[model samples]
Target: MVLGAVVLWELLAAFLERTMDESVYEYLDFVDATDSRIPRRSTRAPGLAKALSLLRGDGRALLFAGTVFLVGAAGSAGHNFLLWQLQDQGSSGLLMGLWVGLGPLAELALHPLRGQLLRALPGCGLELLSLAVLAAQLLSYSLLRAPWAALPVQALSGLSSGALRWRLQGTVGDVATPGSERALLALLGGLCAAGAGLGGLGGGFVLQRFGLALLLQASCAGLGLWILFVLIVRSRLPRRRKINYSRLLAAESSEMSDSEEENEDWLVKAMRDESFNRNWIQQHGIK
Candidate 1:
């Protein structure tokens, strides 16, 4: 059923891609903006096809999807779990939403840095740096005494989310191409969405069982556990067989929110140039 619906949707999208008044490039731009991980492939057929390919390719596709799903699950577990606990921590509804929204807001401040980081470093290094940032955010939660202090933590969410969002696409794009890859990509994306939702639920339940402070303490513990998982599972993964840093970056750039993408474009351009990126990365030791 899942695969069938995707085929139907892909057929519909392909028909539209071919016949729509909008040119395919423009239509692709819409898709890139709407779901950056949708891949800038010339067509939507790959969303399903790639998954099929992955299955045929050493049985690695499903493993790749499942592995990332765990990471996504871990990520959602941390975020949703924390958000729920924070919301229940003696705050008003407005304050709760504002606080929860802070993670993306945090991204607003650090995206430039992340783009630079991705451009200069090995993929493992990028993953480590991103993980480090999230760990710091979790550390903040552990140390925070007042609810207001938690606002700063949300800023980290921006980086956390931005990194995950783009990396998710780049990862999917890296493995599943040939246009028909969209099925796998979309399914992976869908899993990420589902993982985050489940993470939220699990986080809330953990808090209910352990109480807020204990919940947070456990959350921190989980982040550490995830760090270990990254070291073991992520750091050791092979490089993308055909790593297109430029294309990978575009996959990421296209996914940025319109305003956010606009904000990041200058940075993207600067980083893409060899001289500019070298100096920039050197100044920050981004690698």
Candidate 2:
């Protein structure tokens, strides 16, 4: 269904020739002095070396990565317990579908307003708020007797998910090098996946050994640890600086142009050298 939606959107967009607003780019831009002009090279599939380099070079980046990993881990743990709770409650398939779908829909409904919200609150604030909401949702799941009661909670849960996603994207813009966004995104995604796997493994053990209530409680504690990390990092970081995105855009354009010119010059030089070698060989009666 996601693939179908992507294809449908692409077809419609091509038919409409709809131009995106400049504000989209403004929201998505990241700047770094050490970044290279060869975006295609930087944006290639990230390797272990790149991840190591990123972690070893920047302590703050390491903290951010750790936070993401913890969040993913806790979320997956909560999810396992949530499924178990719903199953125990004998939730109907249709009701389960509604519970699952409504949250992302609520999130999608709020995307247009995310920009204004970010202006009013820092990304960390949004992240903290999302964590708070997730905590509430888990509490609801723990307390609510009926599975249907958890349906409305899913909407708010979706809102938290959306907020976190928006904050993460903004973090990428804030921290990623201009040309390395794709690679950085890939690295973060892998970490989240790994964390989720670990969480799932632990959650299953806890559920089988203890019970569902204990699992939910443990997930809450995990989220608390994640919140602590976020708070510590947020407190340490300097005040947010306003970025001049227009200047960054111009700089990126100029950088791309210079890189292309350099590549062309290299090609020309290589051709000239090859021709000179051929001529010299003919004159000297060499093969």
Candidate 3:
């Protein structure tokens, strides 16, 4: 199945490359603000130095990293033990497969509404929603004695994980300095990796010492902490004036069409125009 998926992805990528050359080039041009054909960091600094700068200078980036680390740790500790929990209840392979498969299906079902949700909710609201859903699922799993009881609960993971990732990516993008996105992403990835690794290693010992029920409860507590962190961070963010999302979308679409007709990308133009970027930040309330 994995191999087939890989093959399908390759085919689709090749087809897009072949048939949508101009559109692909336009997107590439938009992302490649430097137009050097190389996506180098604007600062041209070493990775370690850039990371240190973010830690020392960018409070929002630091807060984002800390929040993601806690999320990774809680996710790893709780999720890795889920299969074991089912097995302890004598779940069969078919039941386990159903439990796992339904999650991705639920996540896929939510994709069509993803843009609308993002437009409606603040970034912090999405994170809080993700945490709340995860906490509820963990609580349910902790209370369940029958394997079948846990099957429907698995879908919450799909929803929570999807929302969390979507909000996280947007938060990172908003906080990252122009042309420094790659470096910041690399750094965030490293922190999350470390957190996950530590969580997995520590979780086994915790399960042995505290048992499954306690471990699941602890996971819920961790998620609660994450919710608090998000709230605190949100409080610090600048307040955005209310704007009509539908109107904003229309204006952006019109701007895109006008820019395309002028042989320019809106983003590239924004990168060149200080006032444009400033107005954008002010309008969007991007701190």
Which candidate achieves the best lDDT against the true structure? 3
Candidates in order, TM-scores: namely 0.56, 0.65, 0.67
Sequence-dependent TM-score of model 1: 0.56
Evaluated at residue 234, the lDDT of candidate 3 is 64
Please write out the lDDT profile of model 1 over residues 1-287, one tens digit for every residue: 99999999999999887676347545655766568655444544433554755656733344445544545655655555555555556766777778867666777767678667678764545545555666566667756666677776776676666776666666666666444345665677777677667766776686678755555555556656656765676545564476789998888777776669677897787667978778889999898
Over 4 Å off, model 3 = 1-43, 236-287
Query: lDDT tens digits, residues 1-287, model 2?
Result: 99999999999887665345334433344233224454544555444565557666666567667867876777786665676578778988888778778887989888899888788876567777877787777666767699899788887865577887887788777676544565677788888899889988987898799976777677777677778877877678776578999999999999999999999999999999999999999999997
Q: What is the C-alpha RMSD, rounded to one decimal, of candidate 2? A: 16.2
In candidate 2, residue 214 scores what lDDT?
74
Instruction: Give the TM-score (vs. native) of candidate 2.
Output: 0.65
Which has the better TM-score: candidate 1, or candidate 2? Answer: 2
Distance from true location, Cα of 34 in model 1, Å: 28
lDDT of each: 0.63, 0.75, 0.77
Alpha-carbon deviation at 207 in model 2, angstroms: 0.4
